[model samples]
Target: MSRSQRKQEDPDLGVLSSRTLFSLQRELFTKLGEQGHPDLRPRHGAVLAYLDVAGSRATDLATQSGQHKQVIGTLVDELVALGYVERQPDPADRRAKLIVPTEKGLDHMAKSDAILAEMEAEHAKAVGEEAYAEFKRVFRLVAARQAGS
Candidate 1:
């Protein structure tokens, strides 16, 4: 059976979550593109979403993003080539490298944060503020549980 048919037959939590995630990603990337970071793609979020302005090690990013170290390394390389990030010496561990955001990356991060806030506000408005807050709370709990699993 086709994917749509399967969804229609059983609209489970997994299906709903996947659909919501994809929709959110589409809206987010489209807005980001309009804001001048058109080069970013959904896959890039693996690194960008978990990245810290102060810089982080690839292993940290991998853990935060729930991706493999090798995958994180590849994403970091892409981000570096795109001028979003660079490798710098870790102050604490001179031999280890930190993934530091460049000026362009900082700008992108700021823009993304603003966009996400706007989106959240819109959602809250759509579903009553209290209801939205509760929804987010439940989502976080469920996500944490699933991560452990």
Candidate 2:
């Protein structure tokens, strides 16, 4: 059978997931740009999304983001050049470094959180809060199962 024909017969979970992620990223970065963070990109989320407010190790960010350590290091370098994050001595482990957010990074985080909250609220409103909650629960289950986690 042809690829398109097979696609029509099967569930499009992968395609749907990709489309949803891309849409969210597009909306998110557009708003971020308008809010004074034009330099931010979707790739930056690999670090920003997993980064803790206090600070995080590059290895931790890599693990949390499911990215290679080298990739995380490159992202960290870009973030450092952009003035969003800085490397500071880790107090817990003197030999390790912590990726801490700067004032600008904090502002970006706050704005991103607010934007995502608004987007989720709109989704919940459109599909009824309880239904959206259930969708999330089921989606999480499916995602975890698929990931074998």
Candidate 3:
């Protein structure tokens, strides 16, 4: 069957889209592994992404990530073991510890950005550049609304 025919025959295009996205993420993580950036699971990557952007305390990360503190703590421990993040004393509260991404983590984030950029370029090539930009804008708006809900 033609590729388009197969896609049209699929009952759950949304599910297929989600699976495709998951596979793409796995492929990107595999590339990261080959580069010796530490083997990171999606949960670990989520925490790292959060730290890269917000530089929050563990409790804050747990809350923001909608993960239990113990679970988040375990992920943080793995990150620390991998040398991607470190627990530093929080300046605002000497009793609290802040989870901070290391240089390696920042480097990994840069690599992730490059990967995303490459994907974006592919999308722009497949769909017209203007369509790709519109797709991104609409996706971002929908995502923002979903997050609010």
Candidate 4:
């Protein structure tokens, strides 16, 4: 579907707009910064979100984030330095290190989730219940396709 048509049909779907996504991301990062987490950029936040779902090796993160392995390695280093994550010896593969969120990371995620939940509530209020539900369903389907690619 055309981007404009989608936006008009459901304002919440406008979140797919790069400008809108960036703005929302910046707002969330600002909120994180205010919470005393200064270096939590969107990329770093994505890494945290991924790790939150399950601990994974660096290679796994690279694949899931669609980022180069080298780039994800650099980010992982930064996250380790910031104490938001730690590398643990992967039991399944001793040579590979699994990235896991620290306690502080989990706490930060809780706060971040609260902010995101508020944003979602605003989106639902704007788009109505039915459209909001469809938006989530379709968005997930699209995301799965993109991830597979």
| The candidate that achieves the highest TM-score relative to the unseen native structure | 1
TM-score for predicted model 2 compared with the true structure: 0.93
Using all chains and alpha carbons, the TM-scores for the candidates as numbered come to 0.93, 0.93, 0.77, 0.81
Candidate 1's C-alpha runs over 4 A off are 1-6
How do these models rank on TM-score, best leading?
Answer: 1, 2, 4, 3
* Residue range 1-149, candidate 4, lDDT tens digits: 99878777776633545666798899988988998787788988547766743478888778777788898898989999998889889889898888988888887888888988988889899999789989889988977886678
**How well is each residue in 7-108 modelled by candidate 1, as lDDT tens digits?**
889888898899888998999999999999999999999999989999999999999998999999999999999999999999999999999999999999
lDDT assessment of candidate 4: 0.81
- Arranged by lDDT, best first: 2, 1, 4, 3
Candidate 3 lDDT tens digits, 84-119: 888888889999988887888788878877876887
Q: What are the C-alpha RMSDs, in order, of all predicted structures?
A: 1.9, 1.7, 4.0, 4.2
List clashing residue pairs in candidate 3.
none
Clashes of each: 0, 0, 0, 0
| Two-way TM-score contest, 2 vs 4, winner | 2
Runs off by more than 4 Å, candidate 3: 1-17
* Residue-wise C-alpha lDDT for candidate 2, range 10-62, written one tens digit per residue: 74899778878999999999999999999999999999998899999999999
Q: Is candidate 3 or candidate 4 better by lDDT?
A: 4
Taken over the whole model, the C-alpha lDDT of each candidate is: 0.94, 0.95, 0.78, 0.81
